[model samples]
Target chain A: MDVLKINGKEKEFTAGQFPATLAELLEQLGVEAATVVAEVDGDIVERENFARTRLAPGGSIELVRFVPGG
Target chain B: MASIDEKLRRAVVGVAGLGGLGSNVAAALARAGVGRLIIADFDMVEAANLNRQQYFLDQVGRPKVECTVENLRRINPAVLVEAHNERLTAANVPELFAAADVVAECFDRAQEKQMIVETVLARMSPKPIVSVSGLAGYGKSNAITTRRISPRLILIGDGQSGIDTEPILTAARVGIAASHQANAIIELLVDEIKASAP
Candidate 1:
């Protein structure tokens, strides 16, 4: 069982459903990558590097949409 | 404590986005005795902005940066104001705010706010970036609070009240967030000062 914590919620997945890369995780979650930045296990991952970055099993991921307004 | 004003006066601050948050932050910083302010805003003041923003009716049609300079100077004639009447981009944000001790992210759009926060945290690590989120609509002034998102990133606001949902931007509600941003910046500066005090 590969359970990844996204934002603050915990999502469990089987090996077949688990996302291999950070990009895949974002795509699986249907989050737009063009404007969103990812923090995987406290490390800031740039938008362009999402494809090459690997997701850690049982790691925490915070996909902040960045609370809006001024 | 007597020298706190001297310290604030010697420090430089940058304010990006001269709308409701930016304008009010600039004013509060000026009043707080901060010596220099680098303010940027590309848009012109509109009549609709008068509802919540710090701009006046006569100032409408004028560039926001220019009006901000005028308004800030009126609040504090001694405070030096640096006006940038252009949009801040990814390439330029780091450069524009490099000289500032602290940068205030007061943009309206979520993407722009994220960009500023990311750019500063990546390119200019250790330099604090103060931002506001979800400062739209009326009531719940108590809900507007400041949070230290990271060691160098301090964000202020309700984190839920956006224009898309609340859709009503009142002066009182927006001012609460703006003052929170201003106060957070002051706290950061003062904290640094206290840390170095010997």
Candidate 2:
């Protein structure tokens, strides 16, 4: 099994069947690319390069969205 | 030999907004005896801003920057405050915050917060930026925590909470986050001074 930690939660998937890139992972998670910022394994994934940024087993991802009202 | 309070008095902090977070943060810094403050905001004190923002009823219709400077002076008459009654933009950030030892990003909008953070990070380099996000509605106070995003960026407030159906901003929650931002600025200033000390 391949496991990824997202926002401090562990998510499991079938080995070799996990999303190949950050973009695919975001789509799988139902996250809109424009609304949030992504960080994979402590590296900021620029909006333009999200599709090209590869994902790996045991990787950690943090997605943050800005909140309104100060 | 300058005392700690004197050191704080000599520190100049740039507060980028005079809203709830910025107003409270600036007041906290002023009360703590921070030497100088550079505050900016183009908005005026509206009745709508009274719920969570730091302003009296009589303050409505006055420019936020002016009110903030006046209030800060009242808190600590010796504190030097420079008020800019203009909206912060990427083009003016460098000059506006040139003397700031730390910049507090307190815009209510996400895009504006991002703009100031990116601008300060790119232009200010080593100067720390303390910002707030996801602090809205009446949520648990513990949810407001500070995270050191990078060596130069520290973010306060729960990263997931925001205004939704409630459409409310409570003084309790916003105050917690504002205090967190203020404390982070103080910590960063102390650390910087300690690092540079012989």
**Residue pairs with backbone overlap in model 1:** none
| Superposition error at A51 for model 2 (Å) | 5.9
> What lDDT score belongs to each candidate, Candidate 1 first?
0.84, 0.82
Off by over 4 Å in 1: A5-11, B193-198
- What tens digits encode model 1's per-residue C-alpha lDDT throughout A1-70? 8899886689999879999899999888886676465678776777778899898778998765555666
Per-residue accuracy of model 1 over B1-198 as CA lDDT, tens digit each: 637777788778999999999989999999999888999989999999998899999999999999999998899999999899999988999889987889999998888887887788777867888977778888888888887655777778887787878868888999999999999888878767332222
The model with the greatest DockQ is 1
- Candidate 1 lDDT (Cα, 0 to 1): 0.84
Interface RMSD of 2: 2.7
Model 2: runs farther than 4 Å from truth? A1-28, A32-62, B193-198
| True-structure Cα RMSD, model 1 | 2.7
Best by TM-score: 1
TM-score of chain B, candidates 1 onward in order: 0.95, 0.94
Best by lDDT: 1
Candidate 1 lDDT at A18 equals 90
